[model samples]
Target: MTEAVASDGNHGSGPLEYGERRLLHLQAARKLLTEGEPIRAVARHLVAAGGTLEPWAVAALREAAAEAVALSAEPEAREFLHTARQGTDSPAVAAELTDLDWWIRPAAAVGALTELARTDGLPSPATAVLVRRLAWHGRIEEASELLAARPDPGIDGAVTDAWLSRLYPGAFGARTGAPALDEVAATHPWLRADADPGAVLQGLALHRGALEPLQMSLLALDGAGTLDTEAGWFADLLAAARRSSSRVAEALLIAARARVELRRGELRTAEESAETALCLLTPASWGVLIGMPLATVLESLTEQGRHAEVPDRLRATLPQAISRTPYGLIYLRARGQHFLATGRSRAALGEFLAAGEIQRSWGADHPGLSPWMLDAARAHLALGEPAAARELAGRQLRGPGGDRPRIRAGALRILAGTVGPGRRPESLREAITLAERSGDRLELARCLAELGRAFTEAGQPEYAYAPLQRAWRIATDSGAGLLLAELAAGGLGGPPVDPAEARGLAQLSDAERRVAELAAQGYKNREIARRLFLTASTVEQHLTRIYRKLGVRRRSALAAIPGLVPAADVPRPGRPRPLCARPGMV
Candidate 1:
């Protein structure tokens, strides 16, 4: 008889602590995850544990899969994720327990999805829609095949149509070229969670096809003002989803952002909301995974010029990211951005290349591609490859008809400065237009400040003041550090300091510069480890040494390293003076 024991958040007890069954095997596999154990640890361990695995053993396998993903061990993820997904609902069969999630309580909606998908005894519509939801999660392949496998098209249609309307809202309505819609009966419906019946009724207009589309739209809304009104609609749709034959509704329920309302005015609320969301959705993450949010938060920090904060955040979260997350692009992009911000164009280019590889794997027009292209262009420009940057930018912008404001503004600013004479006016005007349309007040402000610099460089300083002043106003109100830095550096803030008259450089080697540049760009020791192909500990050591040599105490100071930049008529060998702040105050 095996002892039943607990594994984090998994309530009740299980037969044997996974470790106790074959403690030696489990310990050895864990070491292999770090030390390159047997190269066949999973296989070797499975053999040792009697060809059958326990739940904790399964949990351990999942954990190892997670580590492999963190290490960019793509080969391992394909094998591991497939195995874990297979074990999701099996109560009697257990193999490896590295994932831990298997032994623990499965997240409500996700667990429902797993059970319903594998267990056919449930209602037809329930399992059918459940499969479709799984498809959308990008976990399984297309749901169409699963739907085809069912004998009842009517039930499948109802389930699929219901989910579709909820997912895309306004998109569900019929247009001249649209497919003919079969009506879903109002009485057999499951959607009843609406706080206000009128709005949803209006949105759906009693059209069954509109339900999933609407639900999808509501789920994607970002602003508080809109999300506030849409919350009840989401709840209703989610409620309907949960009650439907497919347990997939629980997936959406776990994904619902209605809780985001609780922290309308509080930043802490987002943190709490994210944590709760993570816990709520636990093991099964319908395609709406954690990587996106982690990337989103990191990008927000980049906008704030706090790029150095990325490592600590990643240290806390990366281990938890799903193996197949498309967020791989984002991780590399942020790493590149950190390097670019710190003036290491060449090293940044490597990261951009790595990110581009991942993004391209998804497709060129993938939404994530826009930002990655923009970052890649910046990297090229920093490396003094203006022609290459321009070519890439033109291709990307043309495909989209235009880049998003942030990318457009950045690309144009670079093009305006780098590709001069005849193209200057056209690029500057485009940059200005982007600055205006971004809606991020600070983003617009940075554009304006950069525009002013463009004018001054183009022998139009007299035309620069108005835009600079406008930029200044936006920055003061937004309190964005990067924009503030731009205003100060452009000499529109206060008096400018001479770079040569500034402090001296800390003696650094080529590798340290590479390390510092990436560090400044927000690469954690682990990310840096992967980039440099060195051990995580080695990256830390390099960072420590770089800090000592640079005379600055933290990774944040790498950007301001005076020695890194050639003297701009400033003195050397001292600490950087605090930058002049207020545009006028400076």
Candidate 2:
């Protein structure tokens, strides 16, 4: 009898031991195969075992050799498949060989398998391979029908079902379309034996030349709060897909690019990417697909207080969210934000509550993504309910994602607003630190503005000057007009123009303007000299020129001008560095 090895992995029986010489020949064949020996040479060594080896063992070697040839070219795969079919009538062996070719040369494998099935009715194994090939090409209906037509009570059937569940979770009675991974793992025990959904989808995309499933999987991973924003793997995969020149692949990649850019705080670039993706995808066929990009656009616009520019169709799509999906939560949250920006606190709170309920039910309310807790808190705070706002923010702070810098910054911002004077500064300062670390320009600017306001409210305008100066710089660079207005309202700064006496202020040179701004901030001549990295005599000379231009001799008179701060001052070594030069905002 020939020696048999387990082809079904750990689910099956152990390997059957062979005679010493038979084992040596099998080992030699494997060694030759690994060393890049020609498939024909490796096949000869394995075939020389003849009756000494098990039939299954020979089938295994033949399948491995077929896979090796499939890697070189499609013609070689066809040649190997034809040779194998001529020698064996076993459906199991044919199915195994077909699967190997399915990854590398799927069209040829499918054609040969279809012909074989037509000539002689396919057994469960061969039928399974055919089913996967159909599904891989997006023939979901046909694959479903084929799988339903063939039912086996053996391990082959179980394995087939497991694979279908992994590739298309919807096909196996599991909830699909952004179902949480934990939910899928709990419901579909068969999938527990396979790799993660993202990995499985990636493997299918690479092997079967089916990029759509992987595209959807990327979106699903993002929605499920499982995507690793820091990983370059997804980017590389998208680049590979783009190289294939598949429009759907490029569209999916464009949408994913918008998301990545948004996470990195490149809001304008993100919006552009989103808009490009929206143009590529069909409206009717990709209505659900447009939700994420629309939300990204809304976020960018709302942050910049350009709410009037949001399109009518995008606003109309918000309330039609699919329940229990991540897209639903995102849409609702975005809608609530729109309401908040438009000063409709009650309406915003209603949308937030609905989103919160969905997130709570799913147990996937991560702050890094949905952040409904912060959304609700901001709404309540706007509604003059400090206690409620504090409670909501506190819950988020205690959650798993609280340690994430963005989440921490948001929670701290809310706390800063709610707390008493003594504790407020500490919270706001910590929030600013976290925001800076996260590299979110807008968030850091907001925190700094808030901190400056808090200081001014506490009768400490001198301490408020630095943060407001920094905040003004960031907000101006990022085109955060609303934040600039807020800073202006708090007696800090505005759009780089003096609220009073605009023309004389315009007369000052850039260096004199720097001296005037420092003087206005109450820096003494020597202190201004130190900050500006100039000698006291040069500082005095600049100040004299600034005073002549402003027609004000006293130091306190220069403190009142806006839009005149120059970059001549370097921050002291212990303080956070000044903002880097970024391209002008769109």
Candidate 3:
């Protein structure tokens, strides 16, 4: 029977009974382990069976557990480690188990690993875990020290070094200006100015073919960037991440995708993806990496004018370690944006400046990274300090990452705001060109709005109409409620309202009347949909019918009739009627 099992495990390919097949698979797993071959398939099978390991299979089980750890099959790794421990007592197996536990429950595993380091000296895997955890907790100096004391000289060591490099660029060594295979820049095309993005993505796909799932995820996290041009590559990676058994990898990929979607002005999708990413892991398990998803969620919410939800989201305290990494800068910027949106310019300026200070101290103050300078400039402008705002904007335009189209466009827009009408149009036009190239609809709309305002200020209302109309369309399509409100506030006009249409409000159903009231108050279709618990398409249909019944050609016309306002809040005679109220105010 033993001989038959061995033969079948190695070479047999015919149909067999279920019991026989199990025996053959176990035999095959043992054979592969003895030969030191890849153990992922074997480990997966054993993990799924949830059976007691025979004493003879103990060594193979240990090997399988280590392989599972490498693959980031967290539950399988734990199961194998637990079962193997029940069969035998080995320090190596114990260390491997501790290392695996670090990924699942870092806070609990920290004490065990610290004890191990004191007594037995840290092993390679344990050392890697400690270094990474230390860095994640914002103990960069200590992480660097520990790494320097015990160099891994292995894959774990390489990954650790790459992570540390991102946290503090020159901590390991001076950059060679050439991409290292293990470095994040090698996988991220945007980080490499000289490489062709398409070629880099293709190379990354080929390179990842032999990597384990966890390694693939780590590389993807390191390479995360705007996906405007490499969206196809991003999609392929996201799909692979979703198919993988590593939950952490899938979460990281989803979080990265959320950021890309946010940049593309897909606010609802961005919020959904970020929330999904957060749900995949516990807050403790996320470590410092929580900043990515958290910041993305906050920014998306702020842009969509969901201010009521923002307070709830911010109620959770972030890990102190996040304050020391690049992720911290992003979080600070997002928080500042929220403050700005809520009219707290002083608080917003403080957050933006603090983020900039941290980045400057880290020598990572590149506008492409966070653009906090431009944010500060906007805050200064809101505080009525044009000179201060212009100075900051000028510095951003002359700074290291100024050439990036997105950053440049933002600076140009703020600079335009500070200048006279003679120079405002030129700067805004350039900003529009840069924004268009960057493929950021939010930025494009902002530049167009500014251009329209500049034209209005110059007494060219005719010229203002085209840009304002274009800006409004972009804002509506992108669900940018804040921008929509701003455009409405700036006097986006419609065709002359026919006095005969004033009675159309009485011809509407309650549902249509409710939708029309919100629309008249400058709510975007998406906002109205959410308020009415309906789809945006449904809201659009209602608006279409309302327009026909009211004999109006534009949304602005809806506000022209006093009857659209609720009777309790209708404006009295001789008071200049407000055309639209900002979101949340209504």
Give me the candidate number with maximum lDDT: 3
TM-score of each: 0.47, 0.56, 0.69
Q: TM-score rank, highest first?
A: 3, 2, 1
Q: Compare the candidates by TM-score and give the number of the best one.
A: 3
How do the residues 382-453 of candidate 2 rate in per-residue lDDT, one tens digit apiece?
999999999999988998678888888999999888987556889998998988777667888889888877
Supply the TM-score for candidate 3: 0.69
Which residue runs does candidate 2 get wrong by more than 4 Å? 1-213, 216-235, 315-321, 492-586
Task: Give the clashing residue pairs of candidate 3, or none.
Answer: none
Instruction: Name model 3 segments beyond 4 Å from true.
Output: 3-59, 66-77, 83-91, 102-119, 137-145, 148-159, 168-225, 228-232, 493-586
lDDT of 3 by residue, 299-382 (tens): 987887777678777887777767776667778888899999999999999999998888777776646547888999999999
Cα lDDT, model 3, residue 546: 96
Between the candidate structures 1 and 3, which one is better when assessed by TM-score?
A: 3
Between 2 and 3, whose TM-score is larger?
A: 3
Model 2: how far residue 528 lies from native, Å = 27
Query: What is candidate 2's CA lDDT for residue 434?
Result: 88
